[model samples]
Target: MVFRRKRKYREKIIKRSIWQQLPEESQNFFIETANILRFAGQFFVELVTPPYEHKEMIRQTYEIGYRTLALVSITGFILGLVLTLQSRPIMIAFGAESMLPSMVSISVIREVGPVITALICAGKIGSSIGAELGSMRVTEQIDAMDVSGTRPINYVVATRVIATTLMVPILVFYADALALLGSYVALNLNSEMTISLFLNKVLGSLGFMDVIPATIKTVFFGFAIGLIGTYKGYYSGRGTQGVGKAANTAVVTSSLIIFIIDLLAVQVSNLLMY
Candidate 1:
């Protein structure tokens, strides 16, 4: 009995040591996720307070939203074309090529379009925000704002977060439209479906549930991107290298969180639909 108890204690100690020695990669991930959550909370607090920066937010919105139009549009068009082309052979094999328009559009609007747009934003806007803020932190500009009795979070974080939240949905809307157009072009490559009938079929397959949930998830994606970027940049260390690291981590983490949240959203959407 004593030997068995000793063996159990040894196992416990080994387990504790293993836990303590978690890989550096895992530790960094946890720290980054925690920081994102903390920053998001602070962002919310600032969002509700007075002294709203309407002008700055508008400037940020244009910077983020309008500037990103080209990227999103191009990506949307490619996505739709590729998706349709790839799925066509498989659809034809089943003798169901006629279902292409509705299937392609539904897939795009419901999942691919928004997620792809968000990922594009994650790589572009997310990195820019992180690098910008990280540079500011290194230069002590944020500290200067603090010293001058201005709330840096209220000004910087609030504006970017709100800007992303407002803009991503609009981007998604445009992306959905562009993607559908591309898919329609692809469909015309082999078949002769009329534009009106194709649209009717696509819209018939999609209800408010598909559009609303997908759009809602984009907001969270925006939030995650904003929070991760700001957190990494705000707490950046070292010098130029630190800013690069902050931007790198912001894009990587935000992209990962977007996918994870997307999985959860799909599961929840399935439940709701049933």
Candidate 2:
């Protein structure tokens, strides 16, 4: 059959390491990039316009922020405890046990707190929004909303985005506090570090420069996660399979974007620090 022949020919060309398909892939990437850019532009435009979804946004904030506190707290504590415990041997070898508090505090505030919080949010929240919206699209619920004169973008996308933007920074604050508590707990194991001394050292080591830049970057991270989740879910392919794909791809892609944003944020922070 002609179909079999065409398939065979295509495989033959590919096995020959032909450059014929490279342009197609490049073109597809550009096309996808353009579409995403347009989607983001629409999002911003709708974000500023009137008829805000205040109630929905608030509800989402509670769901996204309050409901996830336990997971974030536990993860943060373990992270801090492990980080301190792992770094302990190095500090002890160098006879820098007294400096452990300051070092751990700086590392948490300047980097670990925001990064870990964002990664967790990306996995928990990003896939959630993506699957929710993807299911709506698959079941034609979004279309029904359109017919009812409801602003799906405003009601769904905007609320989720704004909620994420607000909640992630708050989560980071919790993570930082819990991480410090964990650090204290870890310090007490096989050592006699006092709570007062730990607090004093941590406080002394921190400043506006550490907190402010880290907080600002977290806002951007939250925005990226929400945007990708919303975008992937809103424009997902056809059927329940598409819903699964959307959620899967959203988490993976958003996590990658988080790292990308974090790298850029660190570079910018460094440039500004000098």
Reference-based lDDT, each prediction: 0.89, 0.90
What digit string (tens of lDDT, one per residue) describes model 1 on residues 1-274? 9999999999999988986799989887777667667777888899999899999999999999877999999999989988999999999999998888889988998899989999999999889999999999999999999999899999998999888888888898899999998998888887787899889989888889888899889888888787777877888886999999989988998899899989999999999989
Clashes counted in candidate 1 amount to 0
Question: What TM-score does prediction 2 earn?
Answer: 0.90
Give the alpha carbon lDDT tens digit for every residue of 26-94 in model 2: 767767778778888888888998798888899999999976798899999998898899999999999
Q: Which whole-number lDDT from 0 to 100 does residue 76 have in model 1?
A: 91
CA lDDT, candidate 2, residue 32: 72
Candidate 2 residue spans exceeding 4 A from truth: 1-22
